[model samples]
Target: MKTLKIFSLAAVSVLLSTVIIAQSKTETFKVSGNCGMCKTKIEKAAKEAGAKEASWNAESKELTVTYKSSSTNAAKIQEKNSSSRV
Candidate 1:
């Protein structure tokens, strides 16, 4: 009986951890830009909008964004960047 209880607890812990992991997501998107200033603006705006992490590469024109799904979404981050003209 004790071993069965331990197994059940372990299974519950794994399920909870999976749910927590699913709540945060990282996504990449292409953003239009020309210089270093653009990269700075893009990344900063994303974070200000509740992104946990943001990075923009000028040459590649790709922005990597990480945020909590419960708090924000990828579309919101993109919108923020575009509105800022980043």
Candidate 2:
């Protein structure tokens, strides 16, 4: 009975961790910019806003940012880029 209880507790812990991970997601946004220097500034701000990764496609004006949803979101990420030294 003790071993069964331990196993059940372990399973519950695993399930909770999985739920937490599933709730965290990456989001993207479109940001306007002109040059390479502007791109650097915008990307930097995204990192400061908790984005684990950030990339800008100048041709499309789309910024692809990967951040944990628990830490950041699409609207907030755009705000960061908009306030950069561009």
TM agreement with the true structure for every prediction: 0.73, 0.70
Clashes of each: 0, 0
lDDT of 2 by residue, 1-86 (tens): 99999999999999998788657566666788878987888888888988889998788878888877777887787877677554
lDDT of 2 at 12: 100
lDDT of 2: 0.81
Question: Highest TM-score among the candidates is held by which one?
Answer: 1
Report lDDT (CA) for all predictions: 0.89, 0.81
Tens-place lDDT per residue, model 1, 1-86, is: 99999999999999998789668899999988888888888889999888999999888999999999878999999888878772
Error of 2 at 28 (Å): 2.4
Model 1 residue 36 CA deviation in Å: 0.8
Return the top candidate by lDDT.
1
After superposition, which runs of candidate 2 have C-alpha atoms over 4 Å from their true positions? 1-14, 21-24
What is the C-alpha RMSD, rounded to one decimal, of candidate 2?
3.6
